[model samples]
Target: MKKTRKLIYLLEDNDDIREIIAFLLTEQNYDVCAYPTVKSFNEDIVLGKPDMFVLDVMLTDGNGIDVCDSLKSNQKTHHIPILMMSANTQMFTVKEKCDAEDFISKPFDIDDFVKRIHHYMD
Candidate 1:
């Protein structure tokens, strides 16, 4: 018997952070498709959606909150869960503005990160 891995779309500007996140998720049996820019992610979203989305709160090109709000408002991708990753201490303010499922402040414990991810898993 085998398990079907969940596909994750990760958007982060820092290459090292993205790689580390991808590695951790992959180690946990997730299929991660990471993008450095929101532009690339937006382009790929049209091709297909992912099981989950992990977005950086601050992007070089755009704000992740706007991205999450757009996706939540859309008809097609509204059901997918989105997790916002940020180092911002004012995450509650940002979370209140958008319709993200949850948020994780950066320098977060790996155990807590995994636990939060599972909390939203279907």
Candidate 2:
């Protein structure tokens, strides 16, 4: 039997950032399903659950904190690891509000980013 790739649901509003992260994760051999808006992500999430979630703190339509809260509260998706990313200086407050497994500051090192992802994945 063929091994299945881990699916990651990524929500980042910035076009460049979304593309870059998606590309980086793909190159690392993980399957990524990226979305720019919360509405779009919400629509697709009902179809399937990802092995992990990488959410941006600030979004064009919605904030990732609330998304994180919703997912954590839901019985179906509560167990999946969520990694929150932000360039915001107030991430400490953001971190306290959500139940994500990990938090990473933006402008993060590429090597460190991959390592964090693998930490939860493996």
Q: State the lDDT of candidate 1 residue by residue for 15-100, as single tens digits.
A: 99999999998988889999999999999998876899999989999999989998999999999999999999788898898989
Candidate 1 scores a C-alpha RMSD against the true structure in Å of 1.2
* Number of the predicted model whose TM-score against the real structure is largest: 2
- List pairs with backbone clashes in candidate 1: none
Model 2 vs. true fold: TM: 0.97
Candidate 2 ranges beyond 4 A from true positions: none
Residue 22 alpha-carbon offset, candidate 2, angstroms: 0.3
Which 10-residue window of candidate 2 scores lowest in summed lDDT? 86-95
TM-score per model over all chains: 0.94, 0.97
lDDT of 2 by residue, 45-85 (tens): 99986999999999989999999999999999999999999
